[model samples]
Target: MAATAVPVQSRGDLVLADPASPVATVPAAPQILVPATLSTTLDSRPLDLSPLAGPLAKIAQIEAWLGTELIEREEATRVALTALLSGQHAAFIGPPGTAKSLLILLLAQAFDLSKFITLCSPHSKLEDLMGPLRLSQLPHDIYERLTNAYMPASQLVFLDEVFNLSGSLAQTTHRLMNEREFDNGNRVERAPLISVFGASNQIPQTPDSAAFLDRFSFRLWLGYVSRTNFPRLMALYANRPSSAVLRVLAHNMPIFASQHGLLTLAPPPVTLGQDELFSLMWAAAHIPIPQSILSTLDKLYDDLAGKGIYVSDRRWRQSQDALRVNALLDGRGIVTNDDIAVYTNMFWTTREQRVTIAQVVERLGNPLAVAAVDKRDQAKTAYDAAIAAQADTDLDSGRKMNATVEALGKLKETAQSLEALLAQAQQQAMNPTKIQRALDAVQGWRKELSEYVL
Candidate 1:
């Protein structure tokens, strides 16, 4: 058969040699290719990089208002302020007239206008805090105006006598403060609020509710001004009207807020160690801690435990962070022993425990000094009397004299044991590390007691 050239089909069908035969395999479809080297064009515009300015000069003015004599409660105030700036709620508990409301007002002034809201006692309500639904005359129907009427725009909210609100209202406010959102009848609106400062004359004897208490992230105890600061405060009050001072404070608000932020960013200069942790734990365990104090510690411990309450380890890692914040305000980079003492003293606990621990710490070095001296004197007096009696010779027989001496020795041993226990308790406060050493010494002494005839 003569070879015939097969013609390729153009735009029309072509006859094939065999209709049933499989058509030649179609060539593989061509893949659409993308360029590998497409360059990203740069605008080449310079960034408006500007150095951050330090806190406003007004901050210095506020500090000057605070004056050179500082209150013992100032440390607690700083910690509360920092927590507030971090968008955490705090409760300030103390007797009335400790400037708790004034502090909140100052905090409000520190923020820009419209960023701080102050709701004074016995009058604040849920609607006052979260805005109320207004009926517009034009629309002839109710419309929700998320008004910033009483609410501060992008700022903190201070509620004085927070416990005064009705239970339902307080619960609603608590939820909003915690979740940052509120139900406005038809829809939920999230507010720009950051911190909520709640102050009361006294800690609610019975807390409002667990839900309410949980809303606060920090708790602080505000106390009367130190004796050192009292005279200065009195002089300031005597010389200037509170209203005029408030205006000055208002003018310096921005600066104060900026300074506060700067202080917060500064690294915690102090690191709490094992000894500090032990001291804190000892104080916490012994002291009758207020609800507010417990709440604060619980939050701190929760943060440290990574939100788990059942961790096998009890570490004071969170306390280290708190210590650092404390040190930064104190203007130091390294935490000192003094810092630990100061912080341990600040945590709120029962008065009895506070006094006891303070006494223990104060007498750490002299735990046995007074008692040992008295003991020695008594022992000497007894021994001298015993010798004197032996000189008398005929009153009692040798066996009776020996028995009396042995009883005196037992009395001495009892006194010594008591001295050792007192020393151990004192050492536990001053330096927990020395506790084991003291314990070992006590055990050795106890073992020796077994050898005594008594």
Candidate 2:
């Protein structure tokens, strides 16, 4: 497949003047800055993060808790944490039963963030998402959306099958995410939203839909447990088939709490509280884009452009905040080229483009890991295609089954090659973790393919 072109805007400049560096100022958040005083009296003083400390210190515990017994979501867990802690919108894409919903709920539950959750469809209306207008205002010829506890008023939002939204609803959502304000007819109300989360099984290809997705600064791709991780996933859930996080997210807290024969268990690790979250946001906002980091990003932008991947200027600027927070998550005060890997999630608009970004990031982040990452990605794509082929009733079962076997054979060879490369990288004492993930993926996929064969 030919590479798809993403829009490139001239405003994609990355240099930050020394005097105007973000470190010296508290970046403004409209919600806390000059938010509307809803009928709920939401408008008030701006956020002051000066006194807050160690938000990054407590995030690992949060990540570990959310990741408990979840399969193949190590990187997704970090992306979720970064999106939430950095207060940026993100989209999670994966197949059903892949734990996407479970993961988001755990993140939301950990922070106790006020959230509005809904499923989108072709018939979904704006009123369904933002809520009905104030009846009294309608009488006064003012159509004011009563946003109490709705997407516009909540600190976080999770929309399932978000791409199914009707054109009108999608447009309204685009405005709400990009502007952080709702057009109330009589007034433009500042939203209290910290982040808007979206999930889908596939990427949207239409221009408008692409624009809607661009509103999200980061996108995470989740896959099923590989042959390698399947055992771990099963071992963790051997006695119990369903996810504990699923039960909790379903409002079955008591049932979830009592799942084990032992009636009591220690409390799971947690996010410090909403106040602590505010402080983390404050601290993260103050993290500066050092000239060197910006310069690195500039070169990265060009490299991606060379490969026909174009990220909008706005996306890059917004992503910087999240990257800074990623640094913070590592208990670091400075940003590094290592952090550029986060851009891997930000640049791709389609599944095919994802591998390109991965190869690019891995190449720059760790050259030794590139071949492994590329090989593993190619094998996994073939394996995924084979799995998908079996589901297509139009295809000849005999032919498809044989093709799947061939794909599996190739995947096994690739897995062994990845293992060899991983060992070489490890012996060289280069970053082995990257290659390790690749090796795990192909090995797992190879196992998955074998199961399909049987």
Candidate 3:
């Protein structure tokens, strides 16, 4: 056989001549690199479910001290305690003399030393909260001393005038409030069993930041005592002992801790059921709400929606938790309308909002009672006039007019009756029977309004 001619390999420009030559494969396109950045987006953030430990006895002691001084504030304090025990923070806002600070100290004194720590000031620093660094005293470098001084205990910290802190200091609190940890150089230093009791003369117009606001699970407005409770408060103030009952109660803090500890670890979550909805709807139907009042409710709902404020889905489920506690305090197993009424007040952003919503519910429940009786009289007059004018033309007109006048007379009577029902329904000493009767009467008038256009 003739010697096979050796095939010469081509250089850089060589092309494959064989049908079965291996094809050149291009490397997969490199993934677009994402720059490392801090997450500011709230949606991606995890739920900060850090464990919370608070002395319930302390909360009860504080509540007892509040006594009858500030009924609204007292109720608000109960709600706040419920929120705190459930592992949440509360922000109490009020005028200077509303006893906001007093409540904080009272509550703090109730906690076991291991469970609560109080820090008050306009100049509280992160180091003060986490613990101080001992640079010069340390055998190692200054930074090493700082690393050794971290306190990791679960204690309640009371930050009075919390809004006055510098932005950096506040930012550190924002982290501590949410994550229960602070950035110490390269590592995160967890706080020892930490819970914050922050009080302010007024809630900041704009919170230090959204993160800071989110850290406070409940926001309460503590107003002055009701006029009815003023006398009792005065008596308590005038006869103030060397140590008030609150102090005595607080001194027995361990009793509260034991009682609180006995409370079921996880109480059932709060829920809005048919009874709540009916009670609210009945109240709404009876009250004659002004357009302005309706607008306020709408605005409040919108604001809460926009800011993602109010209770979170998980916490919203716990909104009714206070009801149970309130009931337990009152020695009841099932929550009643009164319990709900008191608890709902705690969730409102302002006194105006709470009063307005209550008014709307009242008006909706009994429109006749809420609407001006004089206006209905005027409407009756107009109807009578229209009937009289038609009477001269036809026999049917005279009969119809007479019938219309009779109907107006009956409506006036019904309206007066409904007004009485409404008065009883709104009474502070209202009973279930009266409320139920008022609800029935109001429902009747609503149906009547639908039928009688004039």
Candidate 4:
């Protein structure tokens, strides 16, 4: 049957006869509390931005641009961007010459952000890192730090040798990273921080050090470019853009930029404002995560704990947004097994657990899980839409609401088929939880809609 569009009416309700079904009215629906921005996050529509690389394009563009020069640092760039999308700090731990500092420079240049970049040392002073106090304020009995372009005042920050911070610098940036604020005189000033990307050779194994590291949601292990890629790396370094060339293209290429050079304009910063970044972060927060994958995560965590590998309670909670952000970056609407493959970057706490956790996640991988999850989401969206239509006062008559009633009838048919799919999944010894839940929801919707069936 051909489906007709639901006509908009001015006075009388224009009834839509769904060729698909004869249902003309809907039953009472429960008042669904839609989440605010947060609820929109939970009830977030299936955001499909595979074409546009999602809302975090600026960050994605930075990652891609960095990848052009950074050899064997793909994971580092990816994890770093994921951390930003998750609105959590990240750490890069590797030996010198592993491009930790270089990656920082490239990343900072790839986008135009108010950044505070510092090379940390044992002698690093808080006054130097966050900025020195105003000399004028000292005589007036005010000790305000002039925090312009400093750690507390920046959006994207990079602290190389992060573990070498002096006591005051460490303590202050800790608050800045975690609390998003800085102590200025007797009061604290809110920071416009997105995430702090830190680089370190090693993490000191003290409880205090561990606590500080915990502030970062991800820590990617950087390694030397493999012997196989050594030739390419060497060639890359040989052909690397010199500071002189960069300056010429940036500062001296106004006239010749178009006539004889590929560098047309000075590097146009691929930038996003704080407002847009916050909105993208919120959109990233809404990316769909499936229950089956989450269930697998539950099993993975339990498995890791059994092996004496405990991820922190806080990390456990934050991993959701991280996973969702990973999905958004991969140009997908929902988290998948491919996105979860990056779990190694998130929860690997120790050298041994790194390999062990990878094995565990591999063992728990379910390729069919995403398909089931997606189907369930589709059913849920259909069910929710039907309910919302039933409750809409503007849908005043049978004609006005028939399209939604028809959707309910279609959902009923879908539920009948899903019941069989659930049965087969159960027979296969797979966790049919998602499919079963989806069927139950559609069944519930059908039951309500059937109350008014005539």
Model 3, runs deviating above 4 Å = 1-72, 113-123, 136-154, 183-194, 207-211, 241-454
- Residues 263-358, model 1: lDDT tens digits: 221122233232222222211211111244335445444442442322222123333344333333333323333223333333333334334433
| Candidate models: Cα lDDT each | 0.45, 0.71, 0.46, 0.68
TM-score of 1: 0.45
Candidate 4 wrongly placed segments (more than 4 Å): 1-37, 50-60, 241-276, 366-454
lDDT leader: 2
Error of 2 at 6 (Å): 48
**Highest TM-score against the true fold, candidate:** 2
Candidate numbers sorted by lDDT from highest down: 2, 4, 3, 1
Query: Tens digits of per-residue lDDT for model 4 on 1-454?
Result: 1113342321121122233433221111122211232433242234434323333566666676777677878778888778876778888888778988877767666554698888888888877787988998899899899999888889889888888865555766677787888889978899989888888888657665666677888887788888968998889767655646655775667666456554412242476555445545654666667776788888888998899989878788888888888777766656765566567777876767778876676557633344455556676676677677767888776743675677676786677777777777667654465567667767776776666555
Task: Please count the clashing residue pairs in each candidate, in the order shown.
Answer: 2, 1, 29, 2
Candidate 3 per-residue lDDT, tens place, 230-255, comes to 88778765755434444455556858
In the predicted model 1, the residue pairs found to clash are 268-324, 288-350
TM-score of each: 0.45, 0.69, 0.47, 0.66
On lDDT, the stronger of 1 and 4 is 4
Candidate number that wins on TM-score, 1 or 2: 2
